[model samples]
Target: MTTPLPVFAEPWPEGVTHRYLTHVGATVDVTGGGDRTGYRCTGCIYGSSGQYWHENVAHERAQAHAEKCLALPRPTQ
Candidate 1:
């Protein structure tokens, strides 16, 4: 069986604006533009509850989460 790739090893999806590397080596993908932006963590249940109206706001939240997140990537089947 092929081993699962780490979250950080995965390619960023379309429209991704930034990728924040978490403490445990996972990634938090930030997407959207203009008045709609959000982030989703690859290793944890942490993410923006909804899109932010400002890009900086989303980035700030994503960066904060990345700095403190310690969850490791889950194994994929």
Candidate 2:
């Protein structure tokens, strides 16, 4: 068995969340800090750019894209 990713344990604006889904794969932790207060994902669209949004839009974007990716047809072996 594999260990799960660390989830946000604090309140909003200081929260971080992550998970690995089929077709969507794994994602780096989405977090923020001083002057960089926002969210980011390495396996998402921004992809390591560390693009931070003012709100939790980062999670929405990543989730939306992942859902679409998961819905895609899987290639046969």
Candidate 3:
């Protein structure tokens, strides 16, 4: 079985964006083996090389996005 890819290594690529795709409970048998413990990315691809993370890596991905997402409530300086 292939190892699930890491999603939060960095933010989504420029021109590309994503939203909460799924909240998987556990890995299904189709993946050979799985955890499904993390978030997945889905949405418009930025360019031809855009990527999608279906593996269980949501916690990291969400944290990364929050750090950059100014739309969310921010602390007063």
Give the top-scoring candidate (TM-score): 1
TM-score, one value per model: 0.76, 0.38, 0.24
**Each prediction's whole-model lDDT (CA):** 0.80, 0.45, 0.31
- Write model 3 residue lDDT over 1-77, tens digit each, in one string: 95563354444433333333222211111111134333322321111122333434444554444334323222225
Shift of residue 4 alpha carbon in model 3, Å: 38
Of 1 and 3, the candidate ahead on TM-score is 1
Candidate ranking (lDDT, best to worst): 1, 2, 3
Residue pairs in collision within model 2: none
Would you give me the overall lDDT of model 1? 0.80
Q: lDDT per residue, candidate 1, 1-77, as tens digits? A: 95554455456778788999876678788989767988889798888767465788888888988889989965565
Could you say which candidate leads in lDDT? 1
Residue 66 CA displacement from its true place in model 2, Å: 1.4
Count backbone clashes in candidate 3.
1
For every candidate in turn, the CA RMSD to the true structure comes to 5.5, 9.5, 15.8
Candidate no. 3 TM-score: 0.24
Predicted structure 2, TM vs. truth: 0.38
